[model samples]
Target: MGRAPCCDKANVKKGPWSPEEDTKLKSYIEQHGTGGNWIALPQKIGIIHIHITHYYSSNPIYLSPPIISFSKQINFSISFFVFGLRMFISESGLKRCGKSCRLRWLNYLRPNIRHGGFSEEEDNIICSLYVSIGSRWSVIAAQLPGRTDNDIKNYWNTRLKKKLLGKHRKELQARNKGNGGILKQENSSSLLLQQNSAQQLHPCWPQIPVLPLSSPYTNQSPSFNDQDSIRKLLIKLGGRFSDDYQPILDGLNLQFPHGSNSLSSTQQIQEEQVHVGSSALGCMNSIGHNQVQFGQSNEYCAELVQGQGSFITTAIGEMVSSNDYSRRLLGGSLEFFYGEEMITDNKIMGACASSSCGQSTNWGETSSSLMYPSLVASNYEGVRQEMPRECAFQELSYPGAQ
Candidate 1:
């Protein structure tokens, strides 16, 4: 009940086609044409038939069919132009399949078939079409004249994909290098700031005080009336500014200049006009016009006695007198930090005492100038032995809280 064979297996030789066989197949199709039947064409073209062995019954089976009458020549010509030419040659003579003969003619032997290297524009078109439609190489090939789907597919795999990968890898490497350089520069600046701060502290002070030097958040002109939040932040930072360190404002209650009187009371810091510098001591005006308190406190002499052991009088003197140093702290916004090793020495207390002596125009400026020298000076000291264990937040808070 199995279907009959298409051709005699023994007579049909299957493998590479010879030049003579190619010529014969090509010549026959050119002269007489396929006659519309591939199965019969092999016999008509002088391919010998032989018996094929049947496996189930161990018997030989032979298959042959009669050739049909030829169609009208006009119909054949129209079909030939539309479908292109065809060939039917079994492996017995030509050693090539009928399909193989058709492909050889259409791809190579057909009229106006150009074969060679693809141009740059064609390559671009192919790549764009492939990307848009995906790997439908035949569709891409149609857009690119004189190119085959197989050729386009092979070129993309062997050439274009590698080219694109190389470019992408180079871009990625360059991006990484830029990022690495930025990180290196930031680290270097931070280290340099710490070193300079360490060098500024006078040697006489016993324990150092640490401060948050700079961060992105500190660079901005923050909303000023948030004194409640500022106070809370300070309280959270171990009550450094809450009681023990609050400035004793004596006789000086400096009023703000004409238009700036609402500073810190009702008006917020002007964000656009504010510019942050290294120490933040110069930009106090941006904090909004508010009352700045200064005092001459002879009563704090008992309080000064506690820091007398570690206080450097000369260091406090120079620090209080330096308008430049005071200006630097006021130049930027207040930034708080935690868990840095700062030496809490008496030089800071001495500076605070010295600051109380001045009836200053800007109390915010004077207080910061007094506080940060100790903060900066404390950073370089040995934290393991000298730093106290009592406070939860051991580092400096913003000077504005003072």
Candidate 2:
């Protein structure tokens, strides 16, 4: 056999709850806590027992036997609800189901139930958590103290989602404008590598590569406030850029997942050590080895450690900036690399002065590259790259050190 219904469906009132009903439900729950029974709760308020439904339909319920006690089930504060306004049934009880009374108190009449006015902080928390956890509204609601799961779900569907989508569209439009707009490159700094390029072409004027209009923004959807962190990082690593500084950073935007399924991209430039996306720039680590690698091409590579004033040196301490003044103003962030196979031909790349740490520096010919910025550029007198090489301590331009 199946379970019986909690109450008589037709006898119960239905529709918007009246203030009287609200007061009754709230007061009863506060006082007795439903005594753990919804059906019995309303009866406690003054419901006359309708023992015989057929007898009450034709005349007075008193003709039927009175029901002093209800069937099984206990210990839950419950009340039924509906859309109706009427005088309080002082003689009869609230005509609502157990579920209705529970919902009325939890959703509306309860204290601290925020109806609306979601703040920007709440919005970010919602957006970030949603991006990470999807449409888990109950879980999301738990994060917002005064918010309810239903309220959040409805808000996301009706408002917040549209807001994010509109912003996403604006970003797309702006990105399109960039394809043929503000980013036209106008200068290039060919760092003094070995010797400056001697082309009659203006070394100061740059040849910025024109990109197509269809390229998408690198980050999926990042919040606007993340800009402060990004700005600080960019300034810290500002000198790290060669000529492509504008373009690379231009592509970087802090992103949140614009769509429920879109992936969130995370980048960190503020760490004690710098890291960014590029085939040419990378940091490597092993048991006791830490190497920062940079190059013009995949086939071309070289190793560098911090040196005095905007410069990097070979694994065995050699001035990367082949000449004098170029050594100070721009350091050795720029380098000329050759192939490992040519280590003995003496055709290119300076030979190691005195091999340190029993390791040899190999230089491969690459077309374009830039390395780490001077750590303590303020005092360029010299730098010490934290690596595992004894010769790493030699002073720049020291006898045969270069």
Candidate 3:
């Protein structure tokens, strides 16, 4: 079965309450309480209907219930109170429902209820409470005396909300236009930093392995001595010694320094420090502590001779000695690059002939300077088409390695 409604919907009045209805509702509630049942209060206020048993009068000869009694003073007050309520129902009488009666008494006709303009303090309080807890109008209403939740809610939706929004927009626009756009700059810079941080953390970005530029242990020359030395170093550096290291560096050898004497002990307790940039000017393997050995007789000279018409030469072409160019290549107070590019009669020809692209350090200047950097260039021209660091690997001969 469906829940029964409190009143008949068709017969009850709605919309604006009449003056007479307001006055009647106010007066009735003040004189006699709603008895905690607003649904019955409407009927009680409409007309007085005393049960024949509750009333007694018969020219001082009326029969009263033998056990029932009443004080004359108390009965008279009750009669007077209901006298106004006992009027007959008319078309012009109050005809509202139970809910309407309740609402009228509580929100409109209640004593001390304020319905005029809200104060600035009230607006501030409303805005603050709304920010903290959102549209809980009843809770907000409790904070302000004499204000109804319905009134505050309507005020916020209609006017107060728009006022706050306009104020916020103006503040943001002024902040942007004044002070050299400081806020925008900080936000943009912070965003850029976050982007860079994300890129650094990306999995696809290559992890740059840390090692001496002249690592010597390449894909071609991994040996046992090198593996053992690296393992000990890693242990000293505080990392786990994995049982699986054998699969990684088990076959590496440790190349000894050239001038070392006979072993003081059976096991090589100490290894020579690899001087990557000190005297190295060509391949790390090929260069020594005090000399560079990049000459015309290097492994790839013949390839260049076959590919290009000329062998590599100094910029001034045999005028300035090779040593001077070597110093410059070593960054002896000055680094060198292709100050001027090589030009040939045929565009297809490589700069293999002692000349090529203009002065550009971008080619091979890794973060750490190569020990045997550009001696290959000084020996011939200032770095021809072949990479100067190729001597370190000493793997392929130039001009499209065979």
Top TM-score prediction, candidate number: 3
lDDT of 3 by residue, 114-218 (tens): 985987667766654443223557756766678888889889877775574455335434644674444444444332233234335542221111112243322
Q: Please, what is the whole-model Cα lDDT of each candidate in the order they appear?
A: 0.35, 0.35, 0.37
Residue by residue across 70-131, what tens digits does model 2's lDDT show? 32223332222234312111234577877777778777877788979998667756654443
Return the lDDT, model 2, position 150.
84
TM-score of each: 0.30, 0.35, 0.36
Sorting all predicted structures by lDDT, with the top scorer first, yields 3, 1, 2
Those runs of model 2 whose alpha carbons end farther than 4 Å from true positions after fitting are: 1-6, 47-91, 181-402
lDDT of 1 at 171: 47
Candidate 2 residue 18 C-alpha distance from true site, Å: 1.2
State which candidate has the highest lDDT.
Answer: 3
Compared with the true structure, model 1 gives a TM-score of 0.30
Error (Å) of candidate 1 at residue 127 is: 1.2
- Model 2 residue 11 lDDT score: 74
> Model 2 — TM-score against the truth?
0.35
- Candidate 3 Cα lDDT to native: 0.37
